[model samples]
Target chain A: MNKLDNQVIIDRLQAVLGDKVHVLGEPHGLLAIQTESAYILELLAFVKNDELLRLNYLTDITAVHYPLQEKQYAVVYHLHNLFQNIRVRVKVFIGGEQPTIPSATSVWQGANWMERETYDFFGIHFEGHPDLRRILNMDDLDVFPMRKEYPLEDPNRIDKKDFYFGR
Target chain B: MSNRITKITPNNPVFYDNDPQDELITLNLGPTHPATHGVFQNVLQIDGERIVSGVSTIGYIHRAFEKIAEHRPFYQITPLTDRLNYCSSPINNMGWHMTVEKLLDIEIPKRVQYMRVIVMELARIADHIICNGILGVDTGAFSGFLYVMQEREFIYEIFEEICGARLTTNIGRIGGFERDFNAIAFDKIREFLKRYPPVLSEFEELFVRNRIFIERTSGVAAVTPEQALDYSWSGPILRATGVDYDVRVTAPYCSYEEFEFDVPVGTNGDVYDRFMVRNEEMRQSMRIIQQALEKIEKEPKGVFHADVPEFYLPPKEQVYNNMEALIYHFKIVMGEWETPKSEVYHAVEGANGELGFYLIHDGGRTPYRLHFRRPSFINYQMFAPMSRGMLISDAIINMSSLNVIAGELDA
Candidate 1:
């Protein structure tokens, strides 16, 4: 799009989202929208498949963990509107206690696996997922390996003598 | 839940008393599959040749890179990004350094920009060649694989001349390249430019007209442009679906705007289209390399780094001569460099697709969070849908055409 057209879209989005729309860094055409999980599904529905927004593509779904932040986890979705030729980032801040957000599978068919990956990595469940099982990790593995609080395997966790002598 | 799962599997009963119950056949398609570039396994539940359901089993090669970054300095992580997508390591190397430079808000010199472009484009070509070549081999045309490897070896030879290592080319330092291309390397690249077109033509000759290859790939794993974009597929894969969006052109990282090249798009979004798109892309990449070389020639050789001496180690002469430089050198080597307290997502056009590194620095030596946007992992997620109704043989071709390098997939 031309420079003026780009500005108009940005202006409209800014007015719509207000303080929730925090532009990061140099803003090389990435619009990040931070909102609550309650508004996630509605917001996603509005952005995706809408004639104006048309972010019909769900590029990726991942979660970011910030141990020090008050909202401990963030579920990030990268969406691209093929018709509009624009990309937007939808972020939902989830607190530490049983973080969950609505799945975008209804909006974009590709969100199925991306949501599963987010669930696998950060333990943030999609509220209405079809089959929310742990992917990319073994079934019995308890902890979310990508979580900030998940303790890394200690180099000394395996004891050779204990294995051989049956200690 | 167990009953629901059981119901999902088919079952039939008539007058027959002892008929076998239909069940999901679980097959692990390798942490070590020939088609999978590295150690990556996908647990697939199959009904006959069709995949009923599939889940990716990653972390076969998790080296704890983020944790390792916490202990090491910013510069040390360059080598690690190299390992993430070994085929296109320089792009990662340059991308990480650019992120650090952005965090520091430093301006790189014009010549350094040219050098970065050269190295990054070379890596992109190498990655595409292997990816497209392997796609051919997986489809039973082995000649393309050989031709592409020979060319990749030539690319590696140039890389070796520039840096010590070929694949894990830790060639560039923070802000710019580790060293300028020596005369020998320059000559070798020029020779490659001359020799590469014929090799590409020969490789194309083997598969472009072959009826078997065409029949196998032309319509298999067909994804709509909307579907591809929604799934976040980029680079050759995205372009193959007719969307001409390229990170290099749209985002213009590492001075990509200055280079004159075309983003080739395909009409049909299928395995054949993806293959054709990548093939044409390699030619574009060569054009980029040639342009970079011309720019490098016109520009005078000087410092290939930002003036940030603290993050970048001091010159060896200064380290040997001055106490301050010696102390700084030790600190840099020991990874005692202080990182800025900021979050930066630096992305570049990797061979497969958009390779992004989301880094959160805590104003310490270590990063608070490190996430790699692995294109292969995201790209592989589309496999089950793409392979569901296709034959097992076509599924193999689709997997190869997707070019999901397991190193990047599992990491």
Candidate 2:
């Protein structure tokens, strides 16, 4: 099994995407690439369809909310090339007000539910998803609960009070 | 008589047209249904017994683990991981620990790695026992389930001897195990190894060639290799599609590279293939455990944990008598230990699939963000599409074969 070199893959991505792609330093040997929101779909398609870099397996589609950043939400995709046993992480930052990116369901069908999950949690809309509905939450619920601004614990619960714990 | 005849003659002009849509009946399988085996709901549009289409609903068991993990410190999250795949909690625990270790760049000792491998493989066997046995039960063969469940009890006894908890065993720590495997624990492990193989074989004999079992599962819910990959299936499910992409082999973690084992694969990717793959995998797991036991014997005893005083807790006696040990223990327990500011994604071949943890820390007491790449959650995505055009009974069998534990699915 010839393992695909991470550096070569990164160089190839940079060469192709030019300044639109920024190499976020490899952490734990996984090549992390930050791409402009506009080129995310193109980059995903290229990586999946590329002969040498057949990153056909979409491991996960998720988003992270960074409340203080200028582009406050990042839609992250983890892609794996099963043949070469290499994985790469692709991230696209979108503004908090209207976080949206093109859906990767077109590339990998597995992205269908994952995109819906991302939407349900962080309110990051995958623009072309066929069914963009709240997946894991109730339909009538009005909040995207995973955003950083929301408190993790229930504020109304009185059983474990701050007065007793001395917060 | 004349009036009745006249009325019948007038009503004879009526005609009717049959609408195909009227025959479709919508059935809700469960948020709580016996066949579902977990808290999952699938609304099926059926034409009598044949399913026309289906929609699945999950999150009935969702506890918002990632949200809660954002508030807890590093060491405190192991219990939460235990709840993800409760049937194979040790794997989840180890996976979480490895993620934190990767971020912190902690190189654990060889003995610690071997110990983890042993516990994780046992958990894997226990998980496969449940999946395969439940698969038999779903196929209406209850005896095989009973036979294998007894074996699972033996495995749990081993876990209890090691960690004092069976189901949600918070078995190991970030650097290594909390305590060394005592003599009794090693004896229990050896005993389990001696006791389990014949029972597993008997369980297999009950199902592998049984006509009824094979007929029910052989061709049901078949997925091609391409489809399996497109859905990002991993672990036994992906191997059942003939991919041969085991994380233990491809990206060796926990010193898996040092051991010798074969990756079992199947061609059809159906319920039967999944059953066979997992069954063979149990044998392979036993082989790995046997080798690990042998390897552990050569290493020195009583050196269970790595020498990471900052991360590992000090012994009780040391903490009680030694002033320096007491302060270190306080700092460690209070979430004040120093750690790196970095991001990492670590994956282990979990019972279901690729269980991964993506962590981002900003030199804080708690992680900035943590995402569990739950295999059950991802693998369950294909259920609806796969369930289309199958009998409701076969669909039940399909769900069992996927082994999507609700706790992991909704995590």
Candidate 3:
């Protein structure tokens, strides 16, 4: 199978989404594009089902937290074209207050757990997910631990304090 | 026959309607079950001996490695990588190092790359040995598991000779290995190469044609190619469904493209197919290791690590004797170094699947945000759906075939 060119994929995405697509250029040779949170589901479906750029594989779904940015959370989607042996990353930025985006489960069934994991860590709500819940954290935990605002270590723990170590 | 009538109170309701369709028993399969092999919980709704549906709950051992990575420097993260997939620590270590190298745009030496290939391939063989042997144990062939497990011990001895640790070996550094492989390590690897093949073949013969093993694994929890792709499956499980996507072949990190080996693929994504794929993959890993050994011998000595003074640690003797070496060592250890403000995603063909590191840096001592694309976490997503309507025994075999390590899954 002939490998699909990255430029071709970017062109196809731009043609479909128009100004809504912001091409972030290829990082480490992966075509990365950022779009609004609202267009995530539609853009993903178009990319997966497109005739020329058939990114049929959903490699991963994860989120990054940027506390200082305007849209503080970025939901990162990695899609792989198995036939072409190429991968592209898609990012959808959402506000920190109510980070909600349409779920990719409609397009790919594998997104169910990944979305739950994203929600579990970064508190990004997937609008149409069937069973969105805490995946890798305690059920009663209220804090999104992956957020930049949260301290990496527990502040209440006195075991590792400098005074205890005689510093 | 005389009829015996038992009286029941209204509250007791002894003679309630017992419809098979309505009576589904919920069984908690783990969080501490022997068959789980790790700390995983699957609440299975069973009808008779078959599972009707399953709800999986991971994170029993979640260490929050991503959050922790934000606080640790690039080199300190190697030890943490050791815990992700303890079965294949060298691969995780190499993957993390390669990600950092990608961010720094540092070119590694050819000898360093070949050494990494050798270590990563050995780790892959160790990982597959555990998976296939455990599958035998899951299917009631205990003797084959024991036989293969002994071979795994020899591999561990080689690891011990290399890094002084058996399981969680923090073996290599960011640029390259901390030191060169000694003669003892190479000898042990050679010994492993000479002894393991016949044992692996014997292990395969025990289960390949066994009627009971075939009945238990063949066509059980079979997934279509579309389903496998949709679930983001990678590694042997993904290849079992006839998808020819391998990170090593596609991306070719650590000089894997130079090695000649075939990606073992299977048509049916069933337990049997997964078993066959992993079994064949072990042989392929051995083939890679043999080629790597021959190549490593041809390379010059004492070129284990790259010449990155800022990142790579100096030798202890140099640190003690030289002032500049001492300062550099202190700076690197104290996390007082600068990094480029960039983001890169690097993946390696991990034992379980595509273990990727998506690192975002802001020129800080630590990463701004780091994400581990754990393949076990992604591949294990299909477990609940695949378990639906399968026999309880078959679900156990299916779980073994998935090879979901709790450390990697919960990380």
Candidate 4:
């Protein structure tokens, strides 16, 4: 294997991913690679099994909500290849109203629950999961609590007017 | 006989069917099953004693730790890590604070960092003992379990000497340990080292060569090194598959780079290999403890904490005498310290696996987002592949070998 520098690796990845890679500066030491929903699984598959860059382990899968952005949710995949012993972060952006990303279960079976959990907390749907249901949340839950726009009610501000209304 | 037969006449129709040659049954192994150390449930589709398929049902112990962390102040989360993976509380505490410190770029003193390494390794041994001993018991080697527990008791005593509690030891703060290592605790660890071997040997005697134990575990949950890596298996699970990857050696956090220890790797990724790896790890942990003891004995007067007192709480003596000290202490206690806005991920090689904390701080006392890459939770993904087609008893042993702490899994 060629011993490539970190920049060379990044440049090579950019060459392969073209305009899909969006290097966000806010999250330090992270390369937020943005891709379309349809290409989610393809990018993951290439990362995991690609000869040049074999990122076999899916370290973590999570979703972050940016309420201000045109794409309100970004599903992130942290991948690591034991052979190369390097980790790469992949992010796919999805619109808030109907957030969805292709499932990477076929590429890495470990993504099964992590994707489900991302869905459970942030309501980001995985297009091809075998069972895409509420994981940590109750079945009756109506809201994705982790969303940036999710309403958070103040516990101390409860109105006593409701208590006296029927009285 | 004819009169008895007549008296026992069939009162109901026989459902108009012939008996099936074979029958398959679905068994729900509880959210309270004795086999599951904590509250865990497994819905098993079985054909006689052989399990066809099984689905693990977790979340019975979920405390919504992530949600709770959002509301609590920074220091308060130290005690919460104690609850996440209760078996290895020190590691959890260390991992959490390390992530926060990484975000803040706090530089702890070498002595304090070394102390963290020693205590964390000790906690890892205690955790592995619980896991390996429980696996032994599940395989019907009860004596091995008893012996391991006895050794664990000694480790627990040292923990009690340091902290008021044993099980949930909220030992470390953000910058360093809550208190300096006492002489008594150090003495207790030395005594434990002497007595620990015979106990581990006794367990090895009872199970290592026992044909039944070996047969039950050896190939029951055989996963290749590649498969283990693919599933993000860590600690014993990853090592059992012949991967010499210990995060202490690989990443070296908390000054683990200073320690001289071997990363034990096994030939096969099976339950037996996991057992062997954990046993060898116990030995390695003893080596680390011995080295730490020698170092501490030589230099007992070294400072126990870092220079960053603003990040860490100041001593009570200084707090009362000095106004600046009082304000810094107050700021730390109130979790109002102006921690720089940043995100960092800290990975520590915990007893079970790679325990990582992905902390995102939005220039606040509390973290904006905190995610735990819990080993138990990820390792449990391999259980289905490991247990399918194995006997029900083998499945139980395999599950035990995986060491899926329900608290960590559900958290």
Scored by DockQ, the top model is: 3
Q: Candidate 2 — which residues are off by over 4 angstroms?
A: A1-3, A162-167, B1-22
| lDDT for predicted candidate 2 compared with the true structure | 0.90
lDDT of 4 by residue, A54-85 (tens): 76778888877778789888777787656655
Would you list the clashing residue pairs of candidate 4? none
In model 3, residue pairs whose N, Cα or C atoms come closer than 3 Å (at least 3 residues apart or on different chains), thus clashing, are: none
Q: What TM-score would candidate 2 get against the native?
A: 0.95
Residues B139-237 of candidate 1 have per-residue lDDT tens digits of 888877887798889889989998878999888887676677788888998899899999999999998999998998998888888788767787788
Q: Per-residue CA lDDT of candidate 2, range B27-95, in tens?
A: 999989998888999999999899999999888988989999999999999999999999999999999
DockQ of candidate 1 (2 decimals): 0.32
- Candidate 1, residues A26-99, lDDT tens digits: the string is 33346666777877777777766455566666666778888888999988776666555466776778885888
Write the residue-wise lDDT of candidate 4 on B163-233 in tens digits: 76799999888888778878898789889889988888888888889999888888877889878877778
Ranking by lDDT: 2, 3, 4, 1
Residue A37 shift from truth in candidate 4, angstroms: 3.5
* Runs in model 1 lying further than 4 Å from the true structure: A1-11, A14-31, A50-59, A79-89, A153-167, B1-28, B35-37, B42-56, B334-339
Of candidates 3 and 2, the better by DockQ: 3
Name the lDDT of candidate 1.
0.78
Ranking under TM-score, best-scoring first?
3, 2, 4, 1
| Interface RMSD (Cα, Å) for model 1 | 3.2
TM-score of 3: 0.95
iRMS per model, in Å, is: 3.2, 0.9, 1.0, 2.2
